[model samples]
Target: MAELVLDPESHFPEELGIYFWLYPYWDQVSVRGCGYMVRWGTPPLVISILKFTPLAFMVTWNAHPGFTIPHTNLCDFIVGNGAAPVDLPLGFSNIPPQRYPEAPGDEGIVLHTPLAYIAERSK
Candidate 1:
């Protein structure tokens, strides 16, 4: 497995007002009729270190042979106020290194979440 590192200087989305990191793994498999398919595996199975709450989060994936299988490629994370949401962000390289506008309140917390997603391929 290759390691994907996040640039500490990167900025989170203004709408979300939080920073996040993503790690992805890809596995290849062979289908009976299909020539090849990619099966995304589970996340790294580790909790994010950063502590921050989030309104909601989502994950999406794409493959070369689109829609050959009957799998839905959308994943979502919804966190309420009571519990603190993971600090990680969504999608690999989704948040680029840049500056973000400060939130309305100065005391507002800046959260950084780390999330991992896995995908599989069939050959």
Candidate 2:
């Protein structure tokens, strides 16, 4: 099992908009991926993983009706309340990055994870 945490300062959003946070776990023993979803409305903003990697993964946004934003991971541009800490299942794939390709979707502006989680998991 691996423990994951979200950095409040790095992951929190300063303004309101579609936001996403990704947790990528990769190691010789296993690779686990997990995170949360937030939106302005019911069901909140839903985010799904289209591709996974040791270093990073690609996520897609599923906005509710009236939400016209394209699917994209906006982890870089927008700031948010940061990612809430969560626990994820453990397992890994032998697949390589080239085997998985990024699809067209909304741009992810805010991407971050907790430094503690990474450190603990790496150990």
Candidate 3:
């Protein structure tokens, strides 16, 4: 489990985005899926419940897929007190990532598009 605590005073007043890449070893099923949750000033939000096929992981690490923080119900989340801890907890599951939240099956080999957010926010 990796937790990222964003300092509001230093990070706020502007929108922020997160991105990552997964490169599981080809030997076996490196991971069942990856879970991401955000705890801002308000109630916690589940950002992503993602998985990959074995074929996806078997490729060269450099060829692994890139993932961006999708736009979920986060627009309202941006409007916050900027005092409470803004926590981002990311994890991988060999079993289920969490029980209360059930993950979906077979998200396919590539999770997200290769496009990035430019200054104009164009794809």
Candidate 4:
């Protein structure tokens, strides 16, 4: 990876040790491709052994990303929240990026996660 130069116009105040705090993560496994901490889906998805293009990557669970629960628990303190079960299949895929959140009723093809979600998943 190339050197990460902090922009002079950064949003932080001029005196805090923010750069020192961020250096570890900012310098960790950054690559030409992005990294993601995804919820591994059950019924593991299979794919062809074809070689990936320069932009392709597999979202494995190493690097101690902390395994996320496969299901959602919605238990309230007083009224008791309803169960928001996470029924999503948890495996990762190297599918190409697409302009998702497609037109209404075109739900069949969509990568529902937000860009921020994709970016922050690794954190």
Q: How would you encode candidate 4's per-residue C-alpha lDDT over 1-123 as one tens digit per residue?
A: 011134533332222111001111111122222232233342221111111222222222222324332221111111212123433222343332332112113323222223223222244
Q: Scored by CA lDDT, what does every candidate get?
A: 0.25, 0.33, 0.28, 0.23
* lDDT of candidate model 3 versus the reference: 0.28
Which prediction has the highest lDDT against the true structure? 2
Q: Is candidate 3 or candidate 4 better by TM-score?
A: 3
TM-score for each prediction? Answer: 0.15, 0.22, 0.20, 0.13
Indicate the worst ten consecutive residues by lDDT in candidate 4: 16-25
78-113: candidate 3 lDDT, tens digit per residue: 445435555433334433322112223343222322
Off by over 4 Å in 2: 1-53, 63-83, 94-97, 103-123
Q: How far out, in Å, is residue 54 in model 1? A: 15
**TM-score of candidate 3 against the unseen true structure:** 0.20
Worst 10-residue lDDT window, candidate 2: 27-36
Give the alpha carbon lDDT tens digit for every residue of 95-122 in model 1. Answer: 3221111111342222232232222445
